[model samples]
Target chain A: MTRRDSFLECEPGVIRLFGAADIGTKGMVSGWSGPEEGHNWNDGVEAACAVAVKPPVTRLMLSVMGEPYVTRARPAQEITLYGNGYRLGFWRLSARAETALLVALEPEWWLERGAKAVMRLMLHMPHSVRPKDINDGQDSRELAFCYRSMCLRPIAG
Target chain B: MAEPALLGDLRERPDGSFDGWCWVPGRPQERLIVDLLVNDTLAISMVAAIFRRDLQTRGYGDGRHGFVLRLPANTEGLDSEALITARERRSGHIFGRVLRAAPAVSAPGGPALDRVERQVDALWQDLDSARPPPEAERPSQRLRSAFGTLAGRLRAQAGRAPWPDGPPIVLPAPVSPALTVAFVARAAEAAFARIAALAPGLALARAELLVIDPGIDPEVALLSSRVRNLRMLRDGAAAGVIAACNLALAHGAGERRLWLGDTVATPSAAALLALARALAKAPPALWLGPEAAISFADVDAPLPPAVSLPARFGMALCVDRAVFAELGPLDPGFGAAHGLAYADLALRARLLGVDLRAVMEPEPPTGAAVEFAPASTAAWALFRSRWGALDPLIAGA
Candidate 1:
């Protein structure tokens, strides 16, 4: 079972990913599988994680580096990202290679609950599938993307 | 010297609205006047008169001592990062918690889209300026053109249908109607008959029924004469359900507006009275009723009051006219997919801190499931373009 306390900050604000620095599994609140050799797969249709941020910052840039579980049968996967409750951005990944998804978090979203708020990031992937259901493999866990890393950088107002 | 028994709290909602309940313990019957201060400056004052069942059940006089203040449009950009506090006017007491206002987010597409819109307008203006002027017509040609216009008008008039050709037949509205039942009649005569069946119940409850129809049904004219206070709107263009509902919203002469589908079972007079009472007492909210029949245990017994509806159960809704107008009219761009339009309105209401309540009856209405037209691809795309996929259930509905 994955726990939220598994996330660790490698530096002041940077969170390293995979192999003793797997922030994805540590910070994942729900909808995720165990860490793999060098990545973490987002299980099921939705995945959420909570990231703590220092106050007085007006905006934050969220960078999610991941690769979709695309195959010959599934040519592309669409993902919609949400911060708190507001939509941050969207992407359609067609290749298996890792891609960086960057979106700016406005003050309204970062400070939604209050001045000091935990930024909750959620990803919605409707086309997620179990490998066994598609005859691709015997793996039955619903997988959409394998996350390599995630970084949050604060931008001065 | 003891402190004045001031019992209440104020909290800021996610959408910047302020809601709280306050009453002097010694004077439970009195409704306190609360002043909202932004950055230590008084912004607005309101009477705590809205009802809250919790307050009443907890020993507050009548529960009509709560207030919900919607964020004023003018205060959006001005007080984005200010401290807000609610103070009782008479006692000079302030709420314990001071809320920090969230910065106002710009409209979905933001400033870049605004710039693009301006460029598109400029291009349209440039195109208009480049157009050639029309050639001056000779006197004989002008006379011939005038005769052609006259013949076309005459032909159009001759071919016009007798039923829905002219202006809509708007009968006299009820004097001081408590509720306005509004629905779009797409099935013409069948829809009109269903609405007409509710006329007697609506009249008994001092509710006016507004029917927006395509005017293609000739039977509607005769039915209109039979029903009292039945205002008919002829949507001759068949501008779809959202547009028709907007027309009804505009023409309805009632304190509260009930947006219903023609297929839903007609609510009894007692059920409508319960809805009206609940709406009257509660703060600004969208009250939703079950699609099935709403029957009371005794039919004559006191009906049950409405309760807060979970976000997922938001389907049909009723709203106060002012609140409905404040939230803005249904986007006619949704076209015939009125369900999506209502869902959009419900979403907006939720964002603005308006409660979505379920109007409950003693015996829960049962029977046939209510039918909602599946959203067209274009309508779904339009809705998604505005709201994204924030709520999957509402989006799918």
Candidate 2:
């Protein structure tokens, strides 16, 4: 008897990729567009998802593979990742090529906040742009970066 | 452009309860809050956020848009022929056709049910026959035998007295406990410490802690004497965790039972009370712990509302004594793989059309020092063999 609901909750160490018809909506909270061909675009200035990790995990590596929506008008896209309200890392993407953002999540960020089970990962992108506003296309939805996959693996000592 | 619509079915179960899935095709990600009405009168309200495998496979975003609601036994105007309908709580837009309640009926013992039962029994027999013969002397058993021989020789050479044997200690029956907390303890000292920490809360809720020790550790005997409301059940034959849990369940005197893991932190008094309240109001659903761990700092924080749980995620499970008795005991065939055993129980409940939900509450942080054993290969194989056809997403499959 497979508990169908467990698949809805994010499990630690399991890499869930976006754009899969079966599991693309696993941990999606808000600020994201519908899954596309091979990726999902962050819809607005902020996007968030939740994950549950084993309680003993003191540190983890948050690896996200995606491409920023950069154009000549906006040469760079600045992205900041936050775990349970604690800023984890920041990256600046200057090209439209796929970029992998790897951030080390320290214990203080999660353990200190009493987030032992589920950690909310919030991606803040102040530079999100709507294609229509930049004269690129008629699309009106605010888009920042499109993610292909995201993984949170525990860092062994 | 197509009109946005709620598509699903709301059927009355044989027990007069209602369960079904609903989602707006254009807004699959939105979890609709639905209301159940009996004869056009509101009966119950629930969030349609339970995942259904069929819904996912059929392209209903994530499939977490289902609900199972048990109406009160004495709900006004509810009868064998009452009209039941489901509608969106916000828009009051009704979904699906009206369903007439079915009279409660005893399980059918007809040919079809009997045939299914026979097939399942045959499958189990086939799996049992396929099991490989046990090794004559495993490495660990051989090492233990050698150590025992060396120790005996040393004792004889020194003319030391043999170890003393005494009858096993029996604990008095608890006086009508409201809840039973049971777990298999791999380490007596750590289990004792957890019990000590949880004693006050257990006492406040009139709960008894049943420690099932396979080793029958002497430390546990000593600790039981010191701790109030702590009961010890020695697994004298070293029967695995599954058997130990069944023993504890049989011997427990509580109205409700909490099957907990040794490494998971015990819930506080408030959390226990919350669970009791939820169980009282809920139908025969399997209540699980939150997906996230509750740390000491957040122990006093307000609990989130209960939500649907996937069967395999909880470290703790609470069920009414009657519900457990109805569902039957955990399958002993799982051996020491208690995790799979619990998941099996949940899945079995689901097969019987029971809801699987999580009780949101602040629980103690899990102990970091102890690492619980993973499920054995044989147990996993057996579980997959039994349930793989039903659930394609069996772990590692």
lDDT of 2 by residue, B2-26 (tens): 4547666564443445677778887
In model 1 chain B, the worst 10-residue window by lDDT is: B292-301
- Estimate candidate 1's RMSD in Å: 27.3
Residues B210-257 of candidate 1: C-alpha lDDT, one tens digit per residue: 777664443333333333334556675877667777777755657787
Supply the global lDDT for candidate 2. 0.62
Error of 2 at B344 (Å): 1.6
The segments of candidate 1 whose C-alpha lies over 4 angstroms from its true place after superposition are A1-157, B1-173, B186-196, B289-315, B358-373, B389-397
Name the weakest run of 10 consecutive residues (lDDT summed) in model 1 chain A: A6-15
Best by lDDT: 2
True contacts kept of each: 0.00, 0.00
